[model samples]
Target: MQLTIWSALILYFCVFLAGLVDSAAGGGGLISLPAYLFTGLNTHTAIGCNKFSAACGTGFSAMRFFKNGALDWKIAFISAICSFISSFIGIKIAFKINPEVLKTVLIIILPVVAAALLLKKNFGVENRVEEISKAKAFRFAAYTGLAVGFYDGLMGPGTGTIAIIVFSACMKYDLKTASGNAKILNLASNYASLIVAVLNGSVIYRIAIPAAICGIMGNYLGAGLALKKGAAFIRPIMVIVICLLFAKLFYDLFARYFLGG
Candidate 1:
């Protein structure tokens, strides 16, 4: 797409916000993808560019988490490896299945998840990793990675947010730690998708490069805030991301099943 200066500014601004939200919680694609489509790029090109920027932004936040000692290296690596492999299988499955089925399921599930988070006041406030056996934690991480990664490849939205929820709820980590862990998982899937986008010659480097710079800045700052504020800061953002994902899914289902768009 040939972007005018105004369109470029708007895209960059949106990407910066996406990086901020994604680094703190997840679901930044809800913002970044729409921004790209609004700029008149086709769906494929928009996805390619968004992946390029998101991968770069996520890398910076992951590094920050590592440096801050918020990440469990063993769990992160295990999940990353599992997700990396399983995503290929998920992609294969996507070709044969109707994505609308998954979307409908998510539409029902998201609200329940959000309500649980809201009602359980102390949901992710405290890190309780010590209560769990190491073996059990690792096993759960692997399972989470496989399931979430597959969902990512199949439906391609809200993957990161789902990862965070699984890490916090199932593994009993604080929200901050869960957010940290989610970054590694996101990085694995993002780069995997990015490579395919590149091979297809879909990425527009002229646009992606500048947007990536903005994304990096946003991620850096957002990660800093999450590191400083802990679970209290991350929890609300996670809820917001979940709501955004719910809205997006509902819209897609409506457009396809009802509007015939």
Candidate 2:
């Protein structure tokens, strides 16, 4: 597809915003996916291209969070390695399934995700002692990695938010720690998908590089604010963004498949 100067520039502008939302919460794909679709790319190419672009921004955010001592590398490394393996399997499975099945499922998924977000305030930012054993913790980490990573490669919605929610609810991680760790795992899953995108040549480097720069800047800004204001601020944003993302997903599916507009 040929790109007009205006279209290219504007799309990159949107990617920057996507990165900001991604760093602060999750589901940034809500923005970047539509931008790629507007370029007339097919679903596969659009998703692959988005993975390539957003992975860079996610990496920057993960690094920032790590530097600030917000992450638990013990868990992050375990989950990341497992996630990478699971995502590879997931992409392959996605190729066989009807994409609309996933879309319809998401219509059912969003409202629940939204409700979960609403209840997130009860989760709290304070750290809790691990009630599970080391063996059990490692087991949970691996399962979460595989499940979420598969979702990342296959559908790419609510990945970060899901990770944070699990970290808190299951692992007893506080909100800030969960967000920080989730960003790292999110980077891993995005990178897993990007490898395939690069192989298939769906990504345009010209668009990706500038957008990545903007995304990195946004991460810096968002992470700075997250660090300052604490999870109380980030938590509300996570809930709202997830709800918005769910609505966007529902609308996209409804228009393309149901309304046929």
Candidate 3:
């Protein structure tokens, strides 16, 4: 499968954009995967390569967050393991079902989430430091990991955003820390999914390599910006990512129903 130079350029450009947005907010796969498919690869291969690039991007951001002391190791580690295991299971389930059902539901929910964010001006801005028991925090982290990880494997978007929201609302963390934690957990899911894709021979390393390089740079820069700017930077990007996810879902629905693809 030889890719034309134009296709390679387009894929690199798309992955670069996806990485930047995903590092700052989440939902980068919303762009990266579609870009892969646009290159005319089979869905499985596209998904596999998407995981490759996405994982690299997330891993870079996670490291930056860790270096900056934004992560809670206990929460991040537990969630990472759970995300990996659950994502593996989710991928298995996804193979058996029609993803359109999930897409339709997301299309409905994304707007509601965006509206909620818009309505609450200071939603992800400040850390509402509530002293909860260690046991409870662990439980919350585990539950969030399993649920969002499952979603990531099954549908492959918004997992990080969901994790960030859970951290902010449930764990009482600030948006910056929440974003950092989300990046680590999200990497686990991407790794699990990428492993599956590799075993199934779904990844195209030729394309994935270049895209991953672009993704790494984007993640590095985006994470740095997030650390510097805080939620003031991440909030609007998160909203925009949600809206893009909505648009992607809408397009998919139209393709499936209207075009009968």
Top candidate on TM-score is 1
Candidate 3 deviant stretches above 4 angstroms: 259-261
Candidate 2 — which pairs collide? none
| Model 2 Cα lDDT, one tens digit per residue, 72-91 | 78888888888888888888
Candidate 3 Cα RMSD (Å): 1.6
TM-score-best of 2 and 3: 3
Whole-model lDDT, candidate 1?
0.90
Model 1 per-residue lDDT tens digits across residues 1-261: 579999999999999999998999888999999999999999889999999999999999999999999988889888988888777778779879889898999999999999998899998888899999999998998998888878877777788889988998888988889989999998888887788789999899999999999999999999999999987888788889999999998898797767777
Candidate 2 has its poorest 10 consecutive residues by lDDT at: 120-129
217 in model 1: Cα distance from truth in Å? Answer: 0.8
TM-score of each: 0.97, 0.90, 0.94
Best by lDDT: 1
lDDT of 2: 0.79
lDDT by residue for model 3 over 1-261, one digit each (tens)? 888999989999989888888888888888888899999999889988999999988998999999999878889899989999999899899879999898888888889889988898888787664587889889988998998899999988778887887888788888899999899899999999898889999888988999999999888998999999999998899898888888878997897778778
Screening candidate 3 with a backbone cut-off below 3 angstroms (N, C-alpha, C), the clashing residue pairs are none
